[model samples]
Target chain A: MNVFVIGIGLIGGSMVKDLRSLYDDIKIFGLDVNKAHAEKALSLGLIDAQTDYDELKKADVVIVSIPVDVQLEVLPKVLDHIDDDTVVMDVGSTKLKVCNVVKDHPKRRNFLATHPIAGTEFSGPEAAINGLFKGKTNIICEVEKTAFKLQEKALKIFADLGMRIRYMDPVAHDKHIAYVSHLSHISSFMLGKTVIEKEKNERDIFDMAGSGFESTVRLAKSSPAMWTPIFKQNKENVIETLEEYIMNLEHFKQLMIDDNFEKIFEEMQDTNHIKEILNGIIVNA
Target chain B: MNVFVIGIGLIGGSMVKDLRSLYDDIKIFGLDVNKAHAEKALSLGLIDAQTDYDELKKADVVIVSIPVDVQLEVLPKVLDHIDDDTVVMDVGSTKLKVCNVVKDHPKRRNFLATHPIAGTEFSGPEAAINGLFKGKTNIICEVEKTAFKLQEKALKIFADLGMRIRYMDPVAHDKHIAYVSHLSHISSFMLGKTVIEKEKNERDIFDMAGSGFESTVRLAKSSPAMWTPIFKQNKENVIETLEEYIMNLEHFKQLMIDDNFEKIFEEMQDTNHIKEILNGIIVNA
Candidate 1:
């Protein structure tokens, strides 16, 4: 099988690395707008060749792993070049916009929209590693739109990578992802901004930051080029989640200001349910 | 020298374990309102004996590692009971209120108000581990109020545990801590609450939650009993930080709504300063 991955950043690079190890006969080709990333991916042996759009026509599988905004522009073009036998998939965070953009395409049935719920804040091909998708959930949206054989091919590839699959509508995927993923990025970025603004002395942040701050702010280091479009693509859901988040923060703030210890204590205790929820997911899954 | 730790929970228990491994002749006594916690600490060898508060008088050093609200109520009494030679210190998050409450006490000179910039979301004696404080910062406030000899002794002990010491006024400590630590807890708790509220299906959250959600919401698992009074004590600073955070989120929301990709991208790019700041602090300190 010939696999071509565009935008050899973290996710794309990691996919190539993990897949190449599993299928030695897989001929991997890389395409990235950033020449440095393409060169790094080659040096790192993430792919067998650095190819262009024309080369995509020969691919048995094509993976578009660019920023969400770029994915909207590049995905259609990649789909246009690939034959009916080619299985095209995208690993973008927001699904609705991409799915809608390609809804009427002649080869739409050959494409699958998936989001492997796995990533570190780090980006680019150098950040890729094997086993990233292992034991993690991969959400596939609008599966009914894809041809049965193509869907089987995509499912087999993901299952071979040790991923559990779930099906959902693109719109539902965007909404759930806004709450679980995009909002986290915004919260973390804002936190980093808030602390930086208040604690002008960067040294103080370093001296004071513990594991809590580190973990909470880890996503702040995420690539802006990658995330800016995700928030833009899922603006409505992001806004709703942000409003609820802000209101929750305000409510807790007011409770604090009033020194209503009883209410504050109760609210925190309720939220502590997250412990059981997280533990259950981690231990059982 | 004999050391007595009041409240053998996460912080206190970890301190006893770390200190015992360092000092061969030091006798450590444990006390916890939770009798199970005291017995567990004894069994874990975190303490030589499970003793009573009346025995505090014989302690060469008495460490009060209790909840902030409880510390305000019990620290004074502990100070009253300790011998003139006993160095009494409380490791609490908010320092201003506790420092002010103990300022006029007759035994004020024997007490040191310290905040160790170290902890995980997990609490209780079982969470205790060796070397929890190594390479972490220990903030000491109102040192002038502490007897010079007692202050020296406290510094020596923290140094022995491999902690870097920083001195600041109680007011500044509380204000800075509210932004750095307390604000993070609220952010995490509310993030968890918002997701739980929006995604009623816990299974959806379990499947959708990646490392980003996990890291951003990790502190939601913290002890409410430990954090409620912290917000209550540092209400003003907490309110100010929350307002700034909410304002930033609102601005980001507007940017997303407007599709002002340039502004959104720039904002996140700027916050990327965290990489440099955090890395610098980690490398230098």
Candidate 2:
């Protein structure tokens, strides 16, 4: 099988790594707008060879793993160049915009929109892991729109990589993900900004940061190039999540101002149920 | 040497776990306002026996690891019972208030104000782990106010547990800690509250939450009984940090409203420096 992975960064590179170990006959090709990243992917053995759009015609699978904004511009071109039977899939964070963009495309049936809920604070090809998707949920958006055979092919690959799949409409995926994923990155980044601004002496933060601070601010290190586009495409939903988040923060502050620690204790006690909910998740790091 | 642990919870229990392994002749006793916790600690071998304040005079060292509010009430009383040579140390999150509470006490010279910057989300005797303080920072405040021999006694224990000692004034310790430690807890708890309120269908959150959400919200699982008092005692600094955090969130929300994704990108890029700074410290999960 011929696998063409475009924009070979963390997600794309990780998929190909899993594919290489899963199948001996598979030949993987990678492409990146950044020449350095593609070269790094090549030297890192993440891909068999670097290829161009023209070679996509022979590809059995084309994985679009770039920033969501770029996915808008590049995905259609990728569809135009791929073979009739080629199964194209995108691993972008936001699904609604990408799904809407290819809704009426000539080869819409060949494209499968998937959001694999997995990642670390690092990025680029070097950040790829061997089993990045193992036991992680992969939300498949508008699966019925894709060709049945292509869905089967992708499902087989996901199964082989030990991924669990859930089907959802692109709109719901974006809305719910705004709460679970997008909002987390924003909250983390903002927390980092607030602390960095307050602690002029970096030594203080270094000396005082505990596991709680490290865990809470971990996502602040995420790639801006990747997350900025996600927030842009899912603006409405992201804004809603942020508004509610800001309101909760403001309300909590008011409770502090009112010296209503009894209420504060109850609020945190209620939220502590999150522990049980989170127990179901398998965090990579 | 006889060591008395005033509250046999995560911090005090873990300390005795280390002390038990670090010395053969030292006898450890524990007391808790909650009878069951002291019994559980004794059963778990975190303490050699359960004892009350009547045994404090026999205490060569007294470690107070209760909530900050409770510490204000109990620390002076604990001082009243301990011998002049008995070095009393606290592992509370907020230092200034605790320091002030015992500032003019007759046994002030025997007390060492210390905040061990280490913990997991879980609490209670069961949450105690051996080597919990290994390579973590332990902030010692008002060190000069502590008798030199008492400081040596506390410092020896810290060294034996492989903890790095940092001397900070109580004012600076509380202020700096509000930004790095207390603020992270608020951000995380509010993040959990926001997501829980939005995703009424908890299944959606369970399915969608990735490593990012899990990391950012991990602290939300912390015991409310432990945190509410810390916030109450450190109200001013905690409120200041919250104001700055809320302002940053509002500013980021404005950036999203204006479609100023470029600025959003830059903001995250600058905050990415946290990763480098965090590398200097060890976080035991």
TM-score for each model? 0.98, 0.98
Candidate 1: lDDT of A210?
79
lDDT against the true structure, each candidate: 0.89, 0.92
* Pairs in clash, predicted candidate 1: A9-A124, A10-A124
Q: Give the poorly placed runs of model 2, Cα more than 4 Å off.
A: A283-285, B282-285
Candidate 1 segments exceeding 4 Å error: none
Residue A9 error for model 1, in Å?
Answer: 0.5
**lDDT for each residue of candidate 1 in A138-207, tens digit (9 for 90 to 100):** 9999999999999999898998888999899988999999999998999999999999999998778887
Model 2 lDDT tens row, A14-133:
999999999999999999999999999999999999999999999999999999999999999999999889999999999999999999999999999999998888899999999999
Best by lDDT: 2
Give Cα distance to truth, residue B149, candidate 2, Å.
Answer: 0.9
lDDT of 1 at A90: 98
